[model samples]
Target: MTLLKGWRYGAFVGFIAGFIGATLYPIVISPMINSDYYKQIQKETRAGVNQEEIQPGNMKVWSDPFDRKK
Candidate 1:
């Protein structure tokens, strides 16, 4: 009985640890690993935007198809 109880407790702790690691890896570790790629994408997106022309009401509404050309 004692041996069975110890095995059960160990299994429970192992499962909890695995779950926490899986949850945190995507939110924390993955970003650090891909930080350079993320920075590059951010730079490219910002470079294409015209900062001065962006305003609250100075926007155009598009239809469902969005068939308009620039």
Candidate 2:
């Protein structure tokens, strides 16, 4: 019983730590790591080349099927 409880406690702690790390990495770590890439994108955008036609694997930059702006 004691061994089982210890295993459960270790598993719970490990799971919580992993979850926190995963959550914080994208918000805190990724931007810092990719700062150079982001700067390049900003430069391209400022140069008016950011609106290139989307390719098959690229994300949809914007869409409005309902013509809501008009």
Candidate 3:
């Protein structure tokens, strides 16, 4: 019974903390961050691009760490 009571108290505290965080995020933290910049960049980057030709800048050519060949 004691163990179950402790679990219930923990769960209730966690729920209250999560609720407070969710309610405060938009009002307190959203304006301080430039979230729109990321969205705009996403829109511009995906606007016009050829998928057939892979851009050299986007390619990650690196040897795998697990490879036995030196």
lDDT, each prediction: 0.83, 0.81, 0.78
Instruction: Estimate the overall C-alpha local distance difference test score of candidate 1.
Output: 0.83
Q: What is the TM-score of each candidate against the true structure?
A: 0.58, 0.53, 0.42
1-70 per-residue lDDT for model 1 (tens digits): 3453677889988999999999999999999998998999899888977654774586554356767777
Q: Write the residue-wise lDDT of candidate 3 on 10-55 in tens digits.
A: 9988999999999998887885596796789878997876654555
Tell me which of candidates 1 and 3 scores higher on lDDT.
Answer: 1
- What candidate 2 gets wrong by more than 4 Å, as runs, is 1-4, 48-70
Q: Cα lDDT for residue 67, model 1?
A: 72
Model 2 clash number: 0
**Better candidate number, 2 or 3, judged by TM-score:** 2
Q: Write the per-residue lDDT of candidate 2 for residues 1-70, one digit (tens) a residue.
A: 3554677989988999999999999999999998998999888777844544643467666677887775
TM-score of 3: 0.42
Q: Is candidate 1 or candidate 2 better by TM-score?
A: 1
Q: C-alpha displacement of 32 in model 2, angstroms?
A: 0.6
Candidate 3 has an lDDT of 0.78
